[model samples]
Target chain A: MPVWQRIYEEINDPGFVILCAAQDTGGEAAAGPIFDAANATFIQVVDPDHIISSAFNFVNVPSAAWVDEQGKIVRIDEGTYSKLHELGEGDTKISFGTDVYSVALKDWVAKGSDSAYVQSAKTVTGNIRQHSSDQLKADAAFRLGNLFRTHGYADKAEHYWDLARSLNPDSVNFIRQNLTLSEEGSAGETFRDLMGDYVKSGKDYYRPLDIQSPLQPKDEDR
Target chain B: MAKAMMAYPELRHPFAEKPIHAEGSTTVLYQGRSITLARTGAGAGLLIQPDDLPGINGFTLKPEGACYEDLCVPIGANLLVDQQGEQWFDLTGFADLLGQPYVADSEQRVWSFAEIPAKRDGMMLDAMAPDFKVTDREAQVVSMADLKGKKALIVTWSSW
Candidate 1:
């Protein structure tokens, strides 16, 4: 969160905005404090329904879409991260995210349409995932679960949530969010095993990023 | 991992058990908004009053059809039903016609509909950002249309 705030500040452009959404089924209680701790001035959203994800057809958290001045999507559905991050320690140490994304983001903010990172309309359209009927139904079921969860119908909530996962096994968001409410936690053995099977089944967990590595440093600094 | 990084099993089902809405009313969930319709025609599927159409999904039933912006879907027989003497709109039927997916808990009188695929054709075909309405932390309504003329990076994250 702070990293995004820092980048938002660095960009310092009145025209550039960040709408950072937390896709937490736990709602405000789960996501509010994190945003508060970051002191995020940019638009902050706590989406219990994962409405943003559904609109963009994103199957996971930390996904993003870059909309240009005319409301055209220039880039989208990447495993967006503000910076490369490492967590845990010793044998369990895990690393994810990327340093190049933020750099490319800065370049886009500065150069607009001319930025090398700005993909063409065709590319952007092609990149958007084509969700099938069952996948779409999965979203409906997930939202139904959230509605049930909100109103304290735990049994119905669990039913619809399980239905969602079964309907769209590709939805990492549903899988992780469901796991988060379980005793085993989000990254426990169950999640690990599911991810392993996911990969072995030949699914692209995160669509491979199109950005080049070893990004060239821009002349200007904020 | 920090204790903060663990899943919050405690937070799940935190709300007190209660009836979702008035016993007779129907609740519809769409685009993050939950609207309860106090009056619905007695029918096999969701038969909402024609007047309630716009509030639920922003499509007004016009002479041509249910229209939003420049796009209009022809009102077919499947979308309208007559129960007793009252004319009602079959919202679930309309959803099926639009290839819109939905989950209905008939026992609870609640229906949750996914994004209507037709509403997203602009984005899928032209790279235009699909419109979505969500309230920010400050309780301000934000939508994709509101972000026009600005370069916006809309990103999703999670504590988990």
Candidate 2:
């Protein structure tokens, strides 16, 4: 069984109320399968406008915020892990290690705040990377690209799209979306080639985007 | 009114027949009629329009007082007119500002604002998560506050 599948089963147990809050910054089509397979109730919040993510100070996906009974945030850990999976045995290594995550979660549930592992509010805030002005500009450029795409200006959109990619090279959505757009038209070769070069650099930032391409060998075996 | 005229010397609009003194961080004139005037630091002041409430910290002038959704705040005796003839509010005089019934005091846990340009960071994770409701899948009325007592793990995932 897959790690997520095992996690799903554990969640479905009657004692546990596995409420998943998805930061659907763009839309909700991708996480649908896991939610369904887990047979668990998933609450999908839309950030199609990114209003929530910006307000909550979320910068990464698979980032989990643990809220206590009083509604105050208790823990925030990045990445997901389950007892059923290995670290490098998948197309994506987005999962956090199972041993570390399970021990922490079990301690949290058993002892609540008394748990020594419970992180302080300062530590939680410290874990969040402070966003820079340059990144905000890149985000704006990407938004403009989306707006252009919506308004039927695909060619002009690529300019802002390329600017966004250059500013924030790790954005898989921008990379893959622009690459797909490039394949649709003749103008995107330079941009596509740029993304190809980033892939060659062995940066984990582009891993998710590379999953769609057949050129790269699957990282699971390696 | 003595209070209004004392606080606001420039509030000499012809249409402000019954200037109501409302106090806050600064004194403000609520004209009975519509007119525009430039205040020193707080921008311009005009007749309280119906639609302008949401933009002004989600406050609307009501018959009882400044109301927000289900709560209402009373103007009380602190509302006064000054000798020079202007209206002002003694914000400090309003003891129960937060507890004002006219003001919607519902505690909201979720923050819903856009990112400002001052903080620049590249997109770290971009994905859309699914939103489901307690009773039905199509119900969109799910609020983050509803899950207050439970530990919620919000995983943002996007298929696109």
Candidate 3:
């Protein structure tokens, strides 16, 4: 069963509405299942040119902003829905006790902005993220890496990607794509061997490869 | 006036050190140490650095009053006046006369007068934080300023 089908079945309630705002970059194909499964009205705003992203300063995907019926914003949070039953539980455990989405959603439905839990303007002003010089440099490197990748120079792409990762180690896409690319080469024989060593040592680089076998036994035999 | 013929019993050197006492009207003291105390009209000490002759240098308090040592002038409600005929308070003169600067404690409260070296300028307290705006799926602006008069909380994150 597709992910969208599952989501459609889950949010069948009449009053519930799921709004998915996606940047039309790389992840839309992965998000297609969920968007299709939504039973409520779905709004897809695609920034194929990334103009909206630049205007909104969106650095990552699935970021959402909640607004009231009057079009006034009430909350903004990252959105992620997975098919795994334990996904929500795992997210709760990892988010350091700050499950803002569930709590804020309930509050918005119950009391609107009049909720005592809502934050004041001053607090919001003090908490916003400002772009630093380091982040700007990382962005430049990441863009250069993308250009290299698109222009048929994988090695140059990898170089810029490495620079980007070093500059901003916290970037999830940078880490994920780099590792995934490393694993995909030559049926991931090298990646699987590395994974075997890591497993033997009780260390984990990332989620284990769940697809077909990563090892090329013929190459080893040769 | 209770007068006592204080003797230089210890053979105090002219330029070494001198003890200061408050007298009723007339003040008679040794001059070799190059210390002057002025009674400013506002009753604040105005200590002047010896290097800079004339300017509102710094402030200090002494047994006599506030004094500007650069001009070697005594300032008070009636003694001295500014060019505009306004009463002057010269604390720089008082320090130049006192030959020492007032020291302040960790809490920025004044402690005692001591010959202290000048300090380098302190680090700036201002810091630049990451500033960004959040918007909804519709590209609507959601700024912190919009939340004024209402309570709100911001959760920073990304959904890669």
Write down the RMSD of all candidates, one decimal each.
3.3, 17.9, 28.7
For each candidate in turn, the TM-score is 0.95, 0.48, 0.36
What's the interface RMS deviation of candidate 2? 20.0
Residue pairs whose backbone atoms clash in candidate 1: none
- Which candidate has the top score in TM-score? 1
DockQ of each: 0.78, 0.10, 0.01
Please write out the lDDT profile of model 2 over residues A34-94, one tens digit for every residue. 4566554445443333333333344444445555555555555355343424445568554
Q: For model 1, give the interface RMSD.
A: 1.3
Per DockQ, the best of the predicted structures is: 1
- Per-residue lDDT for B1-160 in model 1, tens only? 4443447988888888889899799999888888999999877788999999999999999999999899899978767888778889999889878999898999999998888999899999999999998899999999998999999999999888
Alpha carbon lDDT of each predicted model: 0.89, 0.40, 0.34
What TM-score between 0 and 1 does chain B of candidate 1 receive?
0.94
- Complex DockQ, candidate 2: 0.10
Model 2: per-residue Cα lDDT at residue A129:
42
TM-score evaluated only on chain B, model 3: 0.20
Candidates ranked by lDDT, best first?
Answer: 1, 2, 3
lDDT of 3 by residue, B1-44 (tens): 33212112121111222222232111111110113333223333
